[model samples]
Target: MQSPGIPRSREAAPAGWRETADAAIEGGDDPVPSMLTALLRRPATAFSMLAVAVLLGHAAAALLIAQLPRASFGVEAIEDGMIRVTGDDRRYAADAPVAFVGSDGRVRLARVMEDLVPELEPRGSSSEITAIYAERDRIAALLREPGLMLRLPDGRQLPAAVRPGRIETLSSGFWLSFGIALCSSLAGLWALVLRPREWAARMFMLSGLGLALGAITIGALEQVSLATGSRTLFWITHINYLSAYIFGFAIVALFARYPRPLIGKALLAGFAAAQGAIWVMGLLKLDVDMLGIQIFVVLLLALLAVVLAGVQGWLSRYDPALRASFLLIWISLLLSMGLFSIVSLIPQLMGSPDIVPESVSAAAFLLFYLALAVAIARYRLFDLGSWAVNVGLSALVLIAVLAVDLALVLITGGTWTVSLAFLTAAILWLPLRELVLRRAERRRDKRDLLLLRGASEVAFAPRPEQQTVLWSQLLDRQFSPLTIAPVTCDTAAIRADGRILAIPSPLGGTGLVLSYANQGRRLFNSEDRSVATALVALVAEMVDARAAYDRGARAERQRIARDLHDDVGARLMTTLHRGDLETVHADVREAMADMRLIIDGMSDQPRRLSDIVADLRHETVNRLVLARIHAHWPITAIFDDERLVDALQARVLLSVTRELVSNVIRHAGAGTVSIRCALTGNSLLLAVRDDGRGFDVDSDTILGNGLRNTRKRLEELGGSMAVQSGPGGSVIEIGLPLPSREQGMSDRSMAV
Candidate 1:
């Protein structure tokens, strides 16, 4: 049941759970039921259910409003303690007490009826009124005229100040409250659905529930007050206060838990109990003054909670994403509450009518919910620190743009402010912001590059112990871990402390364990893990490569030892047994020279053809002189001195030359030997001719060990050797192709 591409190992899920996880991963089973089960298991499910209930309640309220009978009567005119109204009498009763408007254009409660006596006349001639009246005597005194207009309870206008549209007002308030409640509930449900395990998310769900309840109660209170024409709606007020208490408690809880909880469980529980007590008091309709004091206490506690949360967040070293999310939440809370506070304070300060209504203030809570939702859903939750900075910069730019636009508008008295603001932002602010952001990004990139370079050094480290030390240093620099030690774990994983990361050892045996970050800093993030994974992979490759190289080197050394024992050892033994002291000495000297050449060949330095030719000529002449033979050395360098040859080619060429000279001296009884070196086109040619008794080229006996090894070496170097043997002389010709400049560089790099 394991998924394709996912490895099956002991590190994977346990036996019972593995199959289900694999099925889900492999897309072979329905995962929704399991997911739903998981969601329902969390405490947030209760809040989610509450949200759904709130939504359904709103729907029911809407349906009830639709089924109700419509109001009919409207105010027409006022005259001599009497009011004239117009509407369909069949639908409306004659004596029904309805909402009315007097001369001053204010709504009031009054009885609308058909006149019993027909002598009453309209009084007022002016459309404007001096004042509103609640009593009949005052209303009659003011309504000695009939030119004033009024709106009816059903939202119809009349000539006189008559019945105000109470029904219409109630309908508007109900729908607005219902919409706010529905949205708040949905936001709560969404937070719970997204991250049920998060305590902050649970608190947010409760906050949304509180907001919905508060909106509903407040809206209902407004509707009932309008319908009954009474301000003493004590029961509705109590419910409203209860909802407010719940809302304040939830908001404080959410703030305390957000990003990460700093408050203790006992303290949180105590706070919750106090809020619950306040709610109970409101439910019991306690003394108004006592209720007010409790409500103020709840508000103060919420404010205190917010302040503590802010302090904790500011002091803590959060990862980038958490920092950004916290900043966003802070901004959302501030804007929502700040705007509402401003709206409330402005009217009192200036003694003017309220510019923003209560209904609009209720909708501002949505901002905080929306911000929480975004933070939860985002992929890089801990890396949004840069985003917070950008948000601040953008806000500043916007404010500046607005200020400039206003200034220009006021100065020119024209509609050029918008265009000017756009130009200013495009030409100045945007580019500046981009430059600053790019610089910040470059700093981050530089830090990453430093880690990469350190990893590279570890990869090419000369020893396993050095590699381990370097790797530890790299982790220390990148993550500031407190300690790094070898562990027995075979798989990469996060440790129990949450700050430690365990990476399986690349060198095999004990794995590596990185402890907590230094100074009790923030926990290790995904980005740090990703970088560590890359380092581990690189080190693994290096270890594998080094192992393969050691294996190949051991095999090569064994082959060389076997060859030396079989060929050179036998020759020296035979010479020693025959009591040929001079030949024995010569053989030992040649063996020592060959060993030196082998050592030289192992070096990575590049050799030039001219230098190699000179060394070969010297060795050849010395050997010929030792054999008491005349030597003719006519060598002409046809290639440039800078033309480099690799170690392999130098080794092959030297080996072949030594073999040819030894053959001419020890086997061929040559009196004189001639050597010629020249360059032909892109090839280097070397010919050695000796005036000695030549062997037959076609004879099988003529192919000795020396001749075979010479031919093999030439062939390995991408060259060819030809032997021409006769009675007069024997000639050996070898040709090797020269590599181009680019090829030489490539070969040189490969040698390194």
Candidate 2:
């Protein structure tokens, strides 16, 4: 696709250009006045001026084109010695047709071919023609045939067809005047009565655009039919008319984007979908007709009714922004349609009936653009200010183009001459405009700098002692965003012992500050109040985190204490009962010592109960040896209880703590180790919560034995222990409640 001498891709821009753009956006001082405010005041005036210029230019060009000689088209006939014309731009005259021999030695009917065909066709392509040439009375007979034809040199007949080319001349001045009137009416209505807003303006413009295009196309088609006898242009014109009908709905749908009702949204979506479908069908060569136009019109009218109803409902609710938006939109609709209707009448009055001209569409659009610009500049309609700016700039650029076009037309002698003139005019005008804008900008800059200097001078000026109160009052007045809570400031002053005044915050807290002049000076100079507010929020978050952590820590400690008392104390009491008075005393002392050790060890420790079970399993192996039970410990323990794990881990350990000691004094005759630890849901179980001399667990003495003590301890910790004792060594199981992950709380319910 690249030209032979051109590169496929241009090289990347140097970094300097990017930096300059950034600087422009950020470095501009007082951007509000520089951009937005300036635009709001001057843009409307500029638009109006440009519109006038374009109107003048187009009018001049049209007048010039009109002055050229008119051309004739289609067939001319002689019936009963009277001349009758039946094609486009028909003119009747009595004349005898004669074939003329050209210098090229070809015979031709020069007047009809040159004057008739070119005039009728007029470079307009989408036109149809169905003309016949015969004696006036015979013409009616030829018209009766379905396909009108022309006789060729070979005696063959061909169907009559005219292909109009690019541009067409306006055959009637009245029609042109009618178009001008319609446009003028719309513009006048827009200027005087319509609210200074956007939606109204846009709708007015779009409808005009659609109708104008429709009219132009229709006129071109008529031009073709006048040249060639065919119904093609007529059919194409009808299709265009249908499309224009949809364009009206498109304008209506735009207003639906405003926070409208459900019905409005549905209408908007449905209308858009229909338009899309129509476009797709058109692209696929599906021929739309007058019937299709009727169907779409009915649908659009229904949608419009629904939208208007919704708008009424919204108005009843009384939202000012919505009211403003809807009002503007409706105004646009009325202004455009009302003006269009009036202008459309002119053609009928002038005996050259057709659709309104394209210029009317532009005029309507200008109004719509103005209304929308008002919304963008003030109300931020659709939150689309950026898009509006771009579109506005484009319109301005279009004005410059029109200006260039004017210069080019003035210098027109040939294509090259016109092109050169256009380029030269643009180059000259652009620089001049830029220079004027820069000068205006400099003046604005000077004004802004002077104002800023004044503000800075007032800000930095020296003041007396009395002014400090006035200064604080002023700062408070201007900076209402900082609504500081009242706090007491204690100033240490005029006290022999140097006592500072304590200022209490109104809500709860207090602050102390010296009342010394130096302190006051520093306070006036400081601008770190924002930093203080941020620090307050941060500290609040940290306090919440700490409170949560402390609650968890407290719960953990309580559970551990309960476990130690139940497990270890019971075993120690048993030991004291079995010994003599002195020995019993010694045993008691030893138990007290062990209790102190467990409590001291746990003070700083935050281990979970499951981990303690694993440690207890290994410790129970040594206890078996110490107890001299000389029996198989066969310990397999699992701790899954939340409360019981923390509550009974120490108790479990204490029960096993001196099992080997007791066995040495009583039943354990052997001592190797076999133990395993695991955890499962809902229960913390110790297999060797006991392994000792074989005895009937149900016996009265054994029922109240150390085993009973262990069982009671287990029950207290929300656990149950069972002793399987007979002749072989015993196996004990302590089942305790497990922690619920949810609830995040230990269940201290007694073990069953």
lDDT of 1 by residue, 296-402 (tens): 66457556656855764685444433455666666555545544444433343344323345566676556455665555433344333445445545545655665
Estimated TM-score per prediction? 0.49, 0.30
The reply for model 1, stretches above 4 Å from the true place, is: 1-190, 197-371, 374-470, 473-498, 504-510, 530-644, 671-716, 720-735, 741-752
Candidate 2 lowest-lDDT run of ten: 492-501
lDDT scores in order: 0.60, 0.42
Write model 2 residue lDDT over 1-752, tens digit each, in one string: 12232222211111223333345555457866457434433434434654676466545544543343222324443332233334434334443332223234454232322223222211111111222121211322333334445433223333433333333455453354336434533443233222233343444444444444444444344344343332343344455545456555644554444344334556666776776566455334333332343434534543573466346536633432334344444444444443443344233333332233444443544455455434422233322223334444444454445446545645763222436545765787689778978998998698556534433333333443332333233323322222222334432111101111122221124432222112221111121233223323433344455557778689657655654554356656567567466546545654664576466556543346656655555554544444443434343434553433333345444454344234333454433323333446755444542333566767887554455655665666666766666655655555656565553445444433
lDDT of 1 at 572: 67
Off by over 4 Å in 2: 1-157, 161-224, 227-382, 390-615, 623-631, 635-685, 689-752
Whose lDDT is greatest here? 1
